[model samples]
Structure formats: C-alpha cells, structure tokens
Target chain A: MRYAMVIDTLKCVGCSDCVVACQTENDVPVGYCRDWITETVDGSYPNVVLELKSERCNHCENAPCVRCCPTGASHIIDGGIVLVTPNECIGCGACIESCPYDARYSHPEGGYVDKCTFCNHRLEKGQLPACVSVCPTNCMYFGDLDNPNSKVSRLLKNRKYKTLAPEAGTKPQVYYLI
Target chain B: MQEEIFVSGRDIPNIDPSLEIWHWPIGLYLFLGGLAAGIILFASIVVILNKEDEYPTTVKYASIIPPIALVIGLIALIYDLKNPLYSWQLYTTIRIESPMSWGAWVLLIVTPLSFLWVFSYFSELFPTWDLKFEWLKKFEQFVKKNRKNMAYLLVPLSIILGVYTGILLSAFNARPLWNNAILGPLFLTSGLSTGAAAIILLAKTAQERHLFGKVDLALIIIELGLIIHMLMGMYAGSEVQLEAMRLLVGGEFTVLFFGFVVILGLIIPGILEALEIKGYKVPVAIPALLVLIGGLIFRFVMVEAGQITRYLY
Candidate 1:
C-alpha cells in the first residue's frame, strides 16, 4: 500500500511540536533537523500574510538525492519512504545539495546524511506517528493512500490539495489542504 | 492540579538552525585541477621550445602525472559521497544536461587519453633492440610517429579538463558567489601557473636523469603574467565578486593568496626568471618548489572563499 501524509495548513499554529517529537523519537542530532518550517512573508507591512510551511523529505517518487548519491546509501523503501542507511553513508553531502526541498542533513557525529523516515519504526508497531499523535489541532493525517477507507485517502479524494515544488518532478508524498 | 495545555508558535519543525561549512571539497578540486593544468602547461612549453632531447622526458612525465592526480582527486570525491561506490553509475548513463554528468564523462575520456599519451612517450624507454621481436619494433615505430599528433590534441583537452571544474561550480545560478563569467578565465590562468610550477619541480627532481638542457625563461614569464591576470580579474569584478577578492587580500586567505601565491609562487619565480636572463643562472629548484606550494594555496583560497559568502545577502 502507498502510504502518505495530508497536512492541513489552516489548523497548523506553527508550533514546533512535530519537530521535537521526530528528533526525540529518532535520536536525531541537536543542530540538524529532518523536518522544518519555512515562513514566507510577502508584500509590505500593511498587506502581508505569514505563510508558514512545515516541510520534510517529500519522499518524491523520483528522488534526486538517490540519483546523486554515489552509494546506495540513500534509497526509497517500501511505501514510498525515502530512507538513509547510516552504515552505508560516507557523508559526501551531495544528496543534501541535490535536494531542492532541503530535507536532508549530515549528522555531526556519524557524518552520514539523514532525513524523515515517515516514522517507520512506529509504523512497524502498528501505531500513529509521534507527530500525528501529538498534534493538538489534528493538523496532520497519515494512512495508506491505496486503501479507499483510509483517512488520508478520504481527505485526498474530497479536499483541494497542493504539493511543494511540483516542477521538480519529485512527486512528493506530502499533500497539503489549504 | 489543573491540566493546562499550552503551546507556543515559536517551535518549528525541520528548520536546521545551524549552517554547514563546505570548503574542503572546493579546496581539493582546485588543487587537483591546478596540478593537472600545471603538468600540461609544462609539457606544451617544452614542446614549443623545440628541445628535442628533453621532449620525450617532459611529455612522458607530464602525461603520467595527470592520471595520478586524477586518481587521487577521484578518491577524495568518492570519499565525500554518502555512497562512494554508486558513483560508478554516474558513468553508466550519459546526461548532457547535468554538469556532474559532463564532469564524469570528461574524467573518463581524459584518463585513458592521458595514459595513452604517456605510454607513447615511454615506449622508447623500453628497449626493442632484439630483431626476434619484429612486431614490437613495428609497434614502437608507430607510437613514435603518432606521438606528436597525440600531444597536440592532449594539450587543449587537458586545458578544457582543468577549466571545466570552475565552470561546473559557476553554473549553479543559485550560488551567486560562484556565478561569475570570470571563473573560466580564472581557472585557466591558475591552471597554467600550477602547471608550470609542477613541471619545474619535476624537472628539478629529474635533473640527475639528464632529462633536458635548461628550463626556458620565456615560459616562466608567461606563467607569472597569467597569475597577475587572475588577480586583476578578481579585483575588477562586481562587489559580490570583490568580497571573494577581499577574502584573499587582507582578509581570511591573505596569508595563503599573498604570502604563498604571490611572494613564494610568482614573485620569487619571476625574479629567478629575470636573473637567468641577465646571465646569472640562479638555481631554480628552490623557487620551483615554492611555486608548487603557492599554486596549491591559490586554488584552496579561491575555492573556499567562493563558497563561504552568504547566497541570500
């Protein structure tokens, strides 16, 4: 089954609870983050809108990171989850540069490139991701896209959604409903 | 106890607060490319001088040095990769749109051509006196006859290879610090300077081997001029480009660019070249060594400074 995430931009308060939860659960380094928020304020003072986007590895179907990687260290796993193997990573950071979304990071100690894994560990235990479970406003939804009954599939079918940098041809797994 | 759920908007996800420093790769690429350019320049100079006795030795040594440098550079590049082995796949597919693809192809093409050029030069070193091996003699004659043509082609090919590294970095429009038309010329000039220094060093080491009569002063002057031109280009460019120059002048890379490249690499060599013209054959060994080190620093500073600046501001 193709797994995916649907993020509701309206409900997000830009609180970094998801970032902390992912880092703590994955043991990610302090300085490097696998997911982050970007706040783009357009227009002058009187007519400005603070558009905050919480982004991570889009887990693109056609990943440039994998193409640029000299080794098979970065690859797409089952369910369209782009994962980086710490053992195989040589810390070249080419994948980091290749990524348009800027999702990857090089671990200071390990010297290996890293990004979101869609909380694969939690998925194996048949549980919701830490970010989804902890989100107070219920801004994040995760489920199998192939399953007609899944919450993600229902939202995708019924709502108007958008994907980041679609011109890059990465086919991002993350979908947004305005 | 009142159960109060309080959350602040300041906590964002996925934004890496710390910045990354990427000077090492740029430094390494510059050093390797400079060395390769230096070797080719020296070989061309020897050929143009028409020093027949020295021709074979210079060509043979020059051709061989690039492959060794290329190997070392390739290793450094792969070592930097998250998966070094998958770099081989880059060669399997030919994508003209990507500079990385172009670089991979250039490396592949230049490696074998360099090896062949060297092989042709060193063929005479291997004795084929015995008439019993008729095929070997014929092969040797064929190599000797075609060697000049190969050398002619190899010179421009090597120059392209050397300068392409700069163009590759500059092509990324998003990287404003590297986005300069002067990059190609800068790389070309630095390549010649480094190439000359490398050859001079090799000539000194092979002095006992009686490889040649004397290093030509004309070639030395040309190399010095190239270094001056490179510095002038950096000084005359835009403000963002000038920032890169500042990094080299009185800033972070001052010691490396001025102290090493100018003082040791160019000035001393230029002085020695002038002295040689005035009937004083000052020993070139020491100055050549200094030039070699200076050339390496030139590349290091240029590469690092180009990347250190902020792209947004």
Candidate 2:
C-alpha cells in the first residue's frame, strides 16, 4: 500500500508544535532539524497572503536521493517510507543534495542523512506520525493512498491540491491543499 | 492589487550565519580531484600518441599528480563526513545511478593505475639520470610491460573522473547552481585547460610547452562558451533557478564570478596564450598560474554559493 501525507495549508496557523514533537521523538540534536517550517508571504500591500509551510521529506516515487546514493544507505521500503540506514550511511551527502525540498539533513552525531520518516518507528506500532499527532490545527492527514477508502484518498477526491517541484519528476507523495 | 512571491531561508529571522551542511573540505576535494583528472587525461593522450619520451616533464610530473591529489582529495572527503569510519561501506556496494557510486569506483580504479603509470615513467627516467633502487627497478619493469594496457584503462577513467567532479554537483537537484546539464562538460573542459596550463609550467622542452599552451587556449575558448551557455540557460529557468543564477551574476559572488573567473581565469590567460602562439614573447608561467588559481576559485565559489540558497523560507 502507498502511504501519503495531506496538509491543509488553510488550517495551519504557524504553530511549530509538530516540529518540537518530531525532534523529541527522534532525539534529534539541537541546531539541526528533520522537518521544518517555511513561512512565505505572497501578494503585496493591502492584499498580502502569508503561508506557514511545514516542509519535510516527500518520499517521492521516483526519488533522486535513492538514485544518487552510492551505497544502499538511502532506500525506499514498504509503504514507500524513504529511510536512511544509519549504520550503512557513508555520510557522503549525495542524498541530501539530491532532495529538491531540502528535506534531508546530515545528522551531526550519526554523520548520515536524516529526514521525516512518516515516524516509521511509530507507524510500526500502528500510530500516527509525530507531526500529525501533535498538530493542534488537525491540519495534517496520513493514510494509505492505494486504499480507496482511506481519508487521504477521499480528501483528494474532494479538493484541489499541489505538490512541490512537480517538474523535478520525483512524484512526491505529500499533498498541500489550499 | 499586484502580487509577488519570494523565497528566502531567513529561518527564525536569524542575524547569525545560517547552518552550513557541507563546507571547504568538499570544495577542496572537488578541486583537487578535477585537477588530477585533467592531468591524467592529458598525459594518457600523450602516451597514446607515443610522445611520452619527448615530453618527459609532462609524463613524469603529470603521472605523479593523480596519486597525490586523489589521496589528499579522499582524505578531505572522509574528513568532511560526520562519520568518517563509515566510508568503508562505499566500496562494498555499488549504485550505478549514483554519481557518488561512480566516483567511488573511479577513485579506486584511477588511483593505483595512476601510481603504476608513474612507476612506468620511473623506468625510463631512472636509467638516464643514473639513479635507481632495486624495488623501483623491479616495479618499473612490471609497469613497462603492462604500460600500454594501463594507459588505455586510464584514458577513459580519467575523463570520467574529470566529468564526475562536476557531475557530483549537477546530480544534486537541490542546488540549482550546480544542477545544470552544462556543468559536466564545462568542468571537463576546465580540467583540461588547467591541466594543460600546469604541464606548460613544468615542461622542459620548448615544443612540449608550446603544444600545451595551444591546447590550453582552445580549452579556454570552449570553456567560455560553456559558461555563457550555462548562465543563459539558468537565466531562462524557473523563478528559483533564476534566483540561483542571480547569486553568480548580481549577488554576493558577482565580483568573483565576472571579475576573477571570467577576466583573470579565461580572458587574460586566453590573450597571453594567443600571443605566445603567434610567435610573440610572453611568459607562460603567469597565465598558467592564473588559470590554476581561477580553477580553484571557480570550485570554491560554486560550492559556497550553492549552499547559501534554499527552496523554502
């Protein structure tokens, strides 16, 4: 089954509680991030529009990081959870550079690339990703995209959404509904 | 009402410098690797043309460069990694699609082959200079026997190494400045130009020096074309791509890009080499020196500028 993340940009209010939860759950080091926010201002003068964008790994179907990794450290596994095998990571930074979203970080202590993993550690326990669970706005949704009955599939059927850098040909699984 | 959307990484409104993921070590590694590859490529061609004996400085000096440069480059690369110890894993598995994989294999192949190429030169140079060690003699004999096959092997691998220097960056879709298709050929030409300039500086024979001077001039002209093509392509790209090009054209690195890389690296050196080719007197060493410095500065600027940019704000 193909897993997906749907973020409702209209509902997000720039709160970074998800970021905090992600850091704490993963034991991420200070001054580094596995996922972060992108706050952008569009329009001008009286009609300005500001967007709080929580950006992270897209887990693209055609992942460039997977292609450019010399070793098998960066790989896509079941349900399309793109992950880094820390023990095997040579810390070459190829996967980090290959990501268009700037979603991956070179872990300071581990010397390997790290990014949002759908909280796979939590997923195995049949739980929501840390970000989705902590998001106070209820703006984040996760489900198996291949399952027509899943919430994510219903949301896509009901709304318009877009993916980042579609021209990159990565086919990102994350969707943002405005 | 008018509308505009701008992307900036000004994360947390920080006045402090943003965190850098890769630094000088990676830049230095790319520079040194490119320089060594350029030399090996040119030297392999010389040997294939049966001009090795005629251009002793080009053969001897050039052969030694790859081993030294590749060793230092590999060290810098490992040192840049967060876990330097895990680099050993690069050898056990190969991902054919990854430029880094190609890089790992290229280094493994070219390093030892280049060392033996140097030893092959030792057999030729030692007897004439009347200097010899027993093991060197024996090693040189083996190298001489296999030299032809080795040169054939080095020629393509050196080209791969040279192009890979740029491919390593271009493979990264995250950094728009480096993601251009022209980067591969542009870097290869730059490597060749600087490689020829380096040989010109060390060649003892006037004929060998003049030949390399001409070669360097041609490479510089081609490099100029490639650089322009790369810039123009980026300027026509998406908003983010245009912003990336601005870093080189009108941003922090503008002076370094237009002033150093364009004028000193290509223009001045190109004029000097042209004059010398026309039978006019001009010191080759100065332009050769500038080209080397320019080659280094180009890599440094590209690496740093690429890192300063991001896809989100």
Candidate 3:
C-alpha cells in the first residue's frame, strides 16, 4: 500500500498544534521538530495572500535520501514510509544534502539523521499519525493513496492540490490541497 | 510585486531557511582526496610509460603522498561524521547508485593498493631495511615484481578517486549550486593541476620542473574553461539554478571565486608557469604553492556556497 499525507491549507489555522503533537509523540528533542508550520505571504500590501500549512518529510516514492545514503540507513518500508536505521547511519550528511524539503536534521544525542516517520509505530497499532490525530482543525488526512476509497485518495481526487518542489522529481507523497 | 515569506517552528539547527549540513572538514577532505588522486594518477603514468628512470621523484618519492593524504583525509571525514564508529557499516553492502558508496568502496581498495605500491619500493629506498617476516618479504617481492601491473590498476582507480570527489557533490540534486554536471571534470582537472604542481615543487632538475610546469599550465587552462562552462550552464538553467549561480557571481562568494580561485589560483599561476616553460627565470615554488592554495580555496567556496543555495529559499 502506498501511504500519503494530504493537508488542507484552507482549513489550517496556523495554530501549530500538530507540531507539538508530533514532538510529544516522537520524543523529539526540545530544539528540534519533525513537523512544523509554514506561513507564506504573497503580493503587495493591499492585495496580499497568506497561506499556512504544516510541513514534514514527504516519504517520497523516489527518495533521494534513500539513494544517496552511503549505508542502507535510509530506506522505504512496506507501506512506502521512509525510515532511518539509526545504528547503521554513518552520519555523512549526504542524505541531508539530497533532501528537497529540508526535512531531516542530525540528531544531537543519537549522532544520526532523523526526520518524520509517519508515526509508523502507531500505524502498526492501527492508528493515524500523531499530526493527523492531534490536528484540531481536522485538516490533515492520512491513508493508503492506492486505495480509491481512502480519505487521502478521495480528497486528492476531488480537490485542487499541489506538492512542494514538483520539479525535483522525487514523487513526494505529501500533497497540499489549495 | 513584493512578497515576503515567514516560516515558524523551524528552530532546528542546519535546516532553517537553508541547509548548512557540510562544513570545512568535508571541503578539506575533497581537497586532500583530489591531491592524492592527482599524485597517484601522474605517478602511475610515469611508471606505465617506463619513465621511472628519468622521473624518480614523480614515480618513487611521490608514491608516499597517496597513503598519507588518504589517511588524513579519511580522518577528517570520520571526524566530521556524527557517528564515526558506525562508518564500518559502509562496507556491509554496496549501493551501486550511491556515489558515496562507490567512493567508500573505491577508497577501501585504493588505500591498501597505495600502501602496497609504496611497500614494493620500500627496500630500494632504504637498502638497510629488512622485512621482519619471510612471508611479508616474499609478498613485497611479489608486489615489486608486478609493479607495472599495480601501476596499471592505480591508473584507473586514481582517476575514479579524482572524479569521485566531484561526483560526491554533484550527486546532491537538492542543492542547486552543486547540482551542475561539470563539477566532476572540473574537480578532476583541478586535482591533476595540483598534482603537477606538487611534483614541480619536489623535482630536483630544471627539466623535470619545466616539463610538469607545462602540464600544470595546460590543466589550469582546462580548469578555467570548465569553471566558465559551469557558470554559463547555471546562468542558462532554471530560475533556481540562476539564483544559485548568483551566489558565486555578484554575490557573497563573488570575490572568493573570482579573486581567490580564478585569478590567484588559476590566472597568475598559469601565466607564471607559461613563462617558466618558455625559459624565463621564475621560482617554481611560487606558482606551485599558489596553485595548491587556490585549489584548496576553490573547494571551500564550493562547499560553503552550495550549502547555502536551496530549492525553498
């Protein structure tokens, strides 16, 4: 099953609750985060437009991080969820340089690169990702993109959406509904 | 129209508006790797062409550089690694598509190969020295007997090592400045030029120095051509690449790239070497040292600036 995340930008309130949820769920360091809110403002003063959404690892199908890693530290799992084996990573930063989304950070304590894992632990227990489950605005959707009836697939099918850095050809699984 | 973008919750180190993942150590590693590659490449050619008798320093003396340089370069590389203890995992499996994997494997093979090459010439360099074990003595003899074969292997491996230095940077498609295709050839040419300069510094005779001075001059010209080619390609590329190229030209790195790397590193040295080749009296050390310094600064600028140019920014 191909997993994906669809974020509804219109419904997002820039509250950053999902950011906190991810931190608490994953035990991310105080100075770091796996998912974060981004605010984009466009146009001259009076005609300006603002867009807010949470950003994290795209878990790309053709992931550059996976391909560039010297060791098999970075890899995609059964559901297309990209994961890092902390013990195996040489911490060369090659994966960090290859990521288009700027999603990864070198773990200060573990001495390995770390990023969003799609809450794979919770997924094994048949639960949604922390960011999706904790989003107060209910704007985040997560499910198998291959299943036509899945919420993520249905929203992507029915809505006008865009992925960040589409020209990178990474085939990112994260989509933002405009 | 004026537009502004603000990102929050990005307090993470090294991944804010841009990435600053690689630092000075990586640049130093590239520089040393190139130097060693160039030395081995030229030394191997000297052996393969049967010019070892005439170019004793280039063939025998220069063989000492690859091992020392590779050891120090590898140390710098490991020091930069957050989890250096796990670096051995790099050999567990080779990923064909990964340039880093290729580099790791190539280095693994070439490091020992370089030591063996040097070991083969050990007894001749020190007539009093003797191998502690008969087996090692026999092995040294075997290596010495097949010196030409070893040189043949080193020819291709050294080239791979040289090109791999640049390919490591170019493989990072996310960084606009480093995503260019010319980096491989550019870095290799610079390495060869630096290698020749090292030989010029060490050569005993004026003939040997002048010969490599001419070689350095040619390599310098090619390196300049590649640099121009890279800039032109970037300027003609997508908006992102144009923005990346701007970092090198008319931006923060303008002076470093033009003044330090281009003029100080290439142009002056090129001219001096050209004059030297034409029977003019120029101290070989001046141009040779400048070339080495310039080669080093070029790597530093590339690494630092490439990290600053990103798709999102």
Candidate 4:
C-alpha cells in the first residue's frame, strides 16, 4: 500500500507540536528535526495571505535521493516510505544534495543521512505517525493512498491539494490540502 | 508583489534556509580527481602517439601524477565522509544510475592501473633500481609490452573519470546550479586544459612547451565558450535556475567566479599562452600556474555555490 500524509495548511496553527513530537518519538537530536513548520506570507501592504505547513520528507515515488544514493543507503520500502540504512550509508551526503525537499540530514553521531520514516517503527505496531498523533489541531492526516476509502485518499479526492516541488517530478507522497 | 517565508522549529543545520551539505573537501576532491584524470588522459595520448622519447614529461614524468593525485584525492574524499570507516561499502554494489557509484568503480580499477603504468616506466626513470623477484620482473615486462594496450584502456576510462567529475555534480537535479548538462563537457574541457598546463609546466623542451601551450589555449577558449553557454542556459531557465545563475554572476560568489576563475584563470592564461605562442618572451610557468589555480577555484566556486541554490526555501 502506498502510504501518504495529507496536511491541511488552512487548519494548521503553526504550533510546531509535530516538530517536537517527531524529535521525541524518533530521538532526533536537539538541533535537528524530521518535520518542521513553515509559514509563507504573500501579498503587499494591506493585502496578505499566510500559509503554514508542516514539512518533512515527501517519500517521493521517483525519489532523487534513492536514485542518487551510491551505497543504497537511502531507499524506498513497503508503503513508499523512504528509509536510510545507517550501517550501509557511507555518509557521502549525495542523497542529501539530491533531495529537492531538503528532507534528509546527515546524522552527526552516526555519520549517516537521516530523515522522516513516517514513523514506520511505530506503524508496524499499528500506531499513527508521531507528528500526526500529537498534532493538537488534527490537521495532519495519514493513511494508505492506495485504498480509496482511506483518509488520505478521501482528502485528495474531495479537497484541493498540492505537493512540494511538483516540478521536481519526484511524485512526492506527501500532500497538502489547502 | 512580495513573498516572505518564515519557519519555526526548522533549526536544522544545513537544511534551514539553504543546504550546506558539501564543503571545501568535496571541492578539493573534484579538483584533484579531475587533475588526475586529465593527466592520465594526456599521458595515454602521448603513449598512443609514440612520443614517449620526445615528451618525457607528458608520458613518463606525468605518469607519476595520476596515482599520487588519486591517492590524495581519495584521502580527501574519505576524510570528508561522515563515516569514513564505512568507505569500504562503496565497493559492495554497482549502482549504474549513480555517478558516484560509477566513479567509485572506475577509481578502483584505474588507481592500480595508474600505479602499474608508472611502475612499467621505472627502469627508464631509474636505471639503478632493479626488480629482484622473477614474478615481479615478469609482470613488469608484461606491463611494458602492453603499454599501448594499457593506453587504449586508459584513454576511455580517463575520459569517464574526467566527465564523471562534472556528471557527479550535474546528476543532482535538486541543485539548480549543478543540474545543467553542460557541466560534463565543461569540466572535462577544463580538466584537459589543466592537464595541458601541467605538461607545459613540467616540459623541458621548448617544442613540447609550445605545443601544449597552443593546446592549453584552445582548451581555455572552449572552456570559456562553455561557461558562457552554461550561463546563457541558466538565464533562460526557470526562476530557480535564474537565482542559481545569479549566485555566480551578481551574487556573493561573483568576485570569486569572475575574478579568480574567469579573468585570472582563463583570460590571463589565455593571453599569456597566446603571446608565448606568438614568440613573445613570456614565462610558460606563469600561464600554466594560472590555469591550474583557476581550474581549482572554479571547482570550489561550483561546489560552494551549487549547495546554496535549492528548489525550496
């Protein structure tokens, strides 16, 4: 099943709970995060539009990171989640440079590139991703996109959505509903 | 009319405003690797042309460069690796689509070949030195006999290694500055130019110096043309591509790119070499040195600036 995350920019409060949840759940270093909040303001003087998004790895269908990784460290797994094998990674950072989303980061301790795994370890135990489960506003939706009845599929089918860097042709699994 | 972006909890180093994944060491690796590839390419050409006796620097003396340069370059590369101990994993599998994988494999094959190429010429270089073992002496004979065939192998592999330097950068589609296809030929041409310059620097005969001076001048012209062509393509590309070009043309890297790489590296050397070719009393070392330095600065600028140009905020 192709897993996907649908974030509602209109509902997100820019609270950054997902950022903290991801860090605590994944044991991400203090200065690093698997997901974060982004606020974009567009317009002039009196007219303005602000869009807040919780951004992370898109787990793209045509992931450049997976393709560019020399040692096969960055790869896609079941459900389209991109994961890094820390032991296999030579810490070359090629995948980091290839990612359009700037999702991956070089782990300082292990010397391997690391990024969001959709909380795959938790997913195996039938738990929602940390970011989604802890998001106070419930703006984040995660489920199988392959199942038409899933929350992600319903959101995409019913609402207007967009993906980050669509021009990159990565076919990112992460979707944002505005 | 304007757009402002702000992010909270995005304090991720090297990924917040822009990426700073690659640093000086990567630039150094690319430079030395390209230099080694160029030396091997030219050395192979000199061997294939049967000019070993006339151009000892190009064929014999220069033969010593690739092995040493590659070893040092690899050292720089390994040092830059976050997990340098895992560097051996590069040989486990061959990812055809990955330029780095291609480079790793090519280096594995070419490094030893470069050492062997140098070893085959040891007797001529040092008459007093002797291979005491029969097997070692026989292997040397085999290498000596197949020197031309080795050149044939080296010619294509060196070209691959040369182009791979650029291809490695270009393969990263996420970085607009490095995504262009021209980088392959551009880097290859620059490598060849630097290679020619190195030969000129080491050449003892006026004939060899003048011949390579002319060759370096030609390569410099082509490299200039490619640079202009690359900028033109970037100018006509998407918004991000324009921003990427601005990093070189009018942004922070402008001085480094135009001053060191363009003017000092190409134009001055081109002019000096041209004057030298025209029978003017010019020191060949001056232009050769400039070309080499320019080549190195070009790589540094590309790596540093390319990392700053990204698809996202």
Measured by TM-score, how close is model 4 to the native structure?
Answer: 0.98
Question: What interface RMSD does every candidate have?
Answer: 9.6, 4.4, 2.3, 2.1
The list of candidate 2 runs beyond 4 A from truth reads B1-19, B123-136, B310-313
lDDT by residue for model 2 over A1-178, one digit each (tens)? 9999999988888677778888889887776566677666777778788777677889999999899988888899999989999999988777776777767777656767777898998999999999899999999999999999999999998999989888888899999997
Error in Å for residue A160 of model 2: 1.9
Error of 4 at B86 (Å): 1.2
Q: Using Cα atoms with residue i matched to residue i, what is each candidate's TM-score against the true structure? A: 0.63, 0.93, 0.97, 0.98
- List candidate 3 stretches off by more than 4 Å: B1-7, B12-19, B128-134
Best model per DockQ? 4
DockQ for every model comes to 0.12, 0.50, 0.66, 0.70
Error of model 1, residue A30, in angstroms: 8.0
**Where in model 1 is the C-alpha error above 4 Å?**
A1-14, A21-31, A37-92, A95-103, A106-178, B1-26, B41-57, B126-142, B202-246
TM-score of 2: 0.93
Pick out the ten consecutive residues of candidate 3 chain B with the lowest summed lDDT.
Answer: B11-20
How would you encode candidate 3's per-residue C-alpha lDDT over B1-313 as one tens digit per residue?
Answer: 4343435566544446324678889999899899999999998998899998888888778778889989999999999898999999999999998999999999999999989989988887777987789999999889988989989999999999999999999998899999988999999999999899999999998878888988999999999999999999999999889999999999999999999999999999999999988889998899999999999999999999998887862
Ranking by TM-score: 4, 3, 2, 1
Least accurate stretch of 10 residues (summed lDDT) in model 2 chain B? B7-16
Clashing pairs in 4: none
Fill in the DockQ of model 2: 0.50
lDDT of 4 at B180: 100
Structure candidate 3, residue pairs in collision: none
